[model samples]
Target: MGSSPSTLERHGYTVVRELGQAVLVNSKDGDQCVIKKINLREETGKGSGNTDVCDAVETLLGLSHPHIVKHKTAFADDEYMYIVSEYCSGGDLYQKIKEQSEKREAFSEEQILDWILKICMALKYLHDLNVQHGDLQPKNIFFTEYGMIRLGEFGEFNERARQAGSTKDGALSYISPEILDGKTHDEKSDIWALGCVLYELCMLKSAFSAESTVKLIPKILNGSYPPLPHNISHNLQQLIEETLQTDPGKRPLAGEIIWKPFVLSFLTARSEKSIDELNDNLVKLRALADGLEKVHYGATVGSLTGGVIGAAGGITSIVGLILAPFTLGASLIVTGVGVGVAVAGGATAGISNITNMVNQSTDRKNIRSIILEFQEKMNSVVICLQHITEGMEELKHQISLKNEQQSPSGGTIVKVGTRVSRGLGAVPELVRLLQVANMGKVAAQAARAVRVAEVATGVFSAFFVALDVFFIAMDAKEIHNIRTTKASEADDMKSKLVLQSPEATDSDSGADQEPKSETMKFVKKIRETADELQMSLDELKEIISFIPKLPDIDA
Candidate 1:
């Protein structure tokens, strides 16, 4: 229950309509908005509860994105908290889908593609900021008067109110199986919900429709949805299958989904450009695709290098002795370096391979065939890159945890830094390769590939910078400890001298105290170094964060 229209008028708004617990309110200036009343007193046995809801809403209010519904303002009374958001007169997507269902019609492939693409773009924007929509379904997707979709009904209210097992009979069909199983979720959970919505739109029916939640739970958990109609495009079918995966980690990210060939094809077709323009666009598209394949191959080779270097049996006795004291730190940093070098070297090799392959035939037909062969290798490369990136991230996490527990030794720092430096030395090679790719005729075929190469260069450069900072931090930490120990020793010497010679002059005492003053100076310098290291580490993390957004051809 919420305040009446008359009560809302006191807050400078007049209620136009009651939409469930929300009221469509018109401001004095004729601006319209929807105000939803959230009762913080409502208790939920799961999640972080009302406090989290309040915090979430506060966060959502600060966010202003074109694809996300605007939360204009909020107010509270004794019984309820009110959230005001921009009004979308075209209503929600669910209403549109229901009207189509009533007419016994399903959305065409093109229409579904367009809708999903917009949704994916919105999701990508949210996921990049580590924000989960939590509840994603057709009903939560509102349409503006211009027919653009804006994601709404989010923030803390949905988090605390919505549950897979519910008495209110909510949209359980669109709930991810992981959530139903009482597991915590992330961005991938939204993807699963998106798949359910996509399936429903294409078929004009719920993917797991049931009379009760009991029936629906098992269908979702078992991934037992009805088969797509034979007329559905194979690409769309594959996308749905991937998104509906039982394992959340296996689900493609929203950014990856946006670049799917089916979505790209739909975008190209929707452009309605002339044949010549289309051909030019296709060349750029092909280049992007090729770049992704090369990145994948590079990642694969890098992973192999890491595996070999990390393996106990693979290390030479001499090298092992050099790394023995710093195994954990050196291995992680070296592996990352290997990955960067392999990635760069792989790009150069791929360019050479392509050039050789293309040179054998001057015919356009032969060039096209070679490009096709390259595209065919992309799937394997993508999988390999995923594994490599995941492994490297896991290693970095482990190293960070270890560092938190105990400060590393000076020997370890020097060794790790040396190895990373060697790896980083490959940067010049990467730069040269990038320069060649930029200037070559190959750039004409895959304009995006050059950009990908630039990204790779930036990534490797960031990695080297991060490693350098880590080494400095570790060195500073070690120096700080050494100064502490030396200062302690100096005090002991001074005490011994005082006891041995009670008649020592004030000048002698001052001379002894000079060493202590110098030690304090070292301590101050060490603190400054530590501060610098932290700043560098923060910068490094910012750089690493960009890795996920890199142009993924396979996406």
Candidate 2:
């Protein structure tokens, strides 16, 4: 946007349109993209500047996902840097929504659900990588050809600009209350924005619309909004309500939202396929966790045994060289022991939280509470794993330093350190595997909880075949009871009538036979449905059990 199309052409892109500070461009290969031009010197307020923008762009370039608008490449001239990314032809969701509103139309329930699901999937992906989309709104949601949506306009440039003390514009209505109150935001803030976008889609207006930002802040902080239409389903109403809670802790995570009854009802076949793939990934993760548990246990035992043996052979004599291997081994073992204890504690807390969640799931009010606890515990587990990995690396560095020291025992220490390093080398990889497994486990549990809740709530769809069977059986039982009652009354009447006339007996017999036949068919249906429901419950239990049980590291 800053440079002419001819200037940009020399850099290999034909400018199409200017979007804010970014310009839409077409390459020689006919690839359409949006190029963000950053004037490094102007941004840094210097004659020449560092490569912070360049480094940030490189990080963004590494991110690739279906819902995330892909960053293709980056290059820079002396004064300006250009970052290129995929361009969406259908424009942004905000523009589309504005056009629809102009036509006096609101997005249907199915359309809103589809867009929300796609956005949540992208947010979940980014959150897993610890990247927060600080600015999320309808304008950031770009529609591709065929109406597929991708999240764009992430705050990378804004973030860098802010670091240099520049102001960045954001939509006030879509910002979370926490952010408005001068608090740092995380993934939950994005979820809050999601709630606002969804509300707009349904109502054809903003939830916290105001004449000015000054008025909007008060409404967001107070969590006030126009009530949803009475015709909106209770499930959807509940979801939006919880997401817009003023307290960030009360909001359900992006991962948890996917499993809500309202969201699950609109899941497409492709969504189911993704769930299956996720299931497979979780299974692989559990196996990885199992292997890591074993390694952790082995390392702890090895460290403790080595330390005791080394201490027993005193290091106060010339024979310390003979005991050098034992000493080095003890140092490595001590490191492992420290890591093991931390991991064990974290695992124990996570299990406790999960158990509480499972127990309290029936209480809708308590669902958010349990999720908050679970999220906190999982965060602790991740921190513990990260610490363990860092500690192992530090241990390796220390051993290397020791090996460099000039001493008669240096050779022995080097030899022992090398062996120990090799043994502990896999610790980082194991930690990484567990971290990934934990994420998968969280998503799986959330999905399972949703399915179970659907059955309990009587929302029977094709996806819930077992639940449908159970409901059908209940309906048959009710019909059978009604028919049986009618048949009994007819028998009583027939007894009275037979005393008066023999003709009534013949007619009553046919009616009585029909009721008996109908009752038998209904009974059969009830039995079949009951069996199917049981099978479904059994299958669900198996899926829940697949959530990897972290070893009692505390023990």
lDDT tens string, model 1, 1-555? 247565578778987877764678888645678887765566434445567667777877976454678788877676556788888877898898999999998788778976786677678778877888877888889976545568887634664434334332356777888888898868889999999988988887788887777787899999899999778877678788888998887677775665442343344334222223323323443333333233222322222222222222122221233333322222211232222233321222222232232222122222232222222222112222232233233323333443444565512333222221222223444223323332223213233333333343443344334333433343344334434544565555444433442112112454335322222333233333334333333332332333332111222
RMSD, each candidate, Å? 28.1, 30.0
- The true-versus-predicted C-alpha distance at residue 149 of model 2, in Å, is 0.3
| Model 1 poorest ten-residue lDDT run | 306-315
Worst 10 residues of 2 by lDDT: 309-318
The 0-to-1 C-alpha lDDT of every candidate, in the order given, reads: 0.52, 0.53
Indicate which candidate wins on lDDT.
2
The TM-score of predicted model 1 comes to 0.48
Model 2 C-alpha lDDT per residue in residues 1-555, reported as the tens digit of each score = 556566678877887777766788888655568887777778677533556677677768988665778789887777777778887777898888889999998777767877787788778778888888878888889975434578877865555433334455447778898888889889889989999988888888889978777887899999999999877766567778878999888787776665432243244233334334434433432332232223222222222222111122111121133222222112211221222222311222121221232122122112122222222222222222222233234343534545455465554444324322322323444334334454444445545544643452242222134323332453344334434544566555434532633223223464344322221333233334334434434444454444333221100
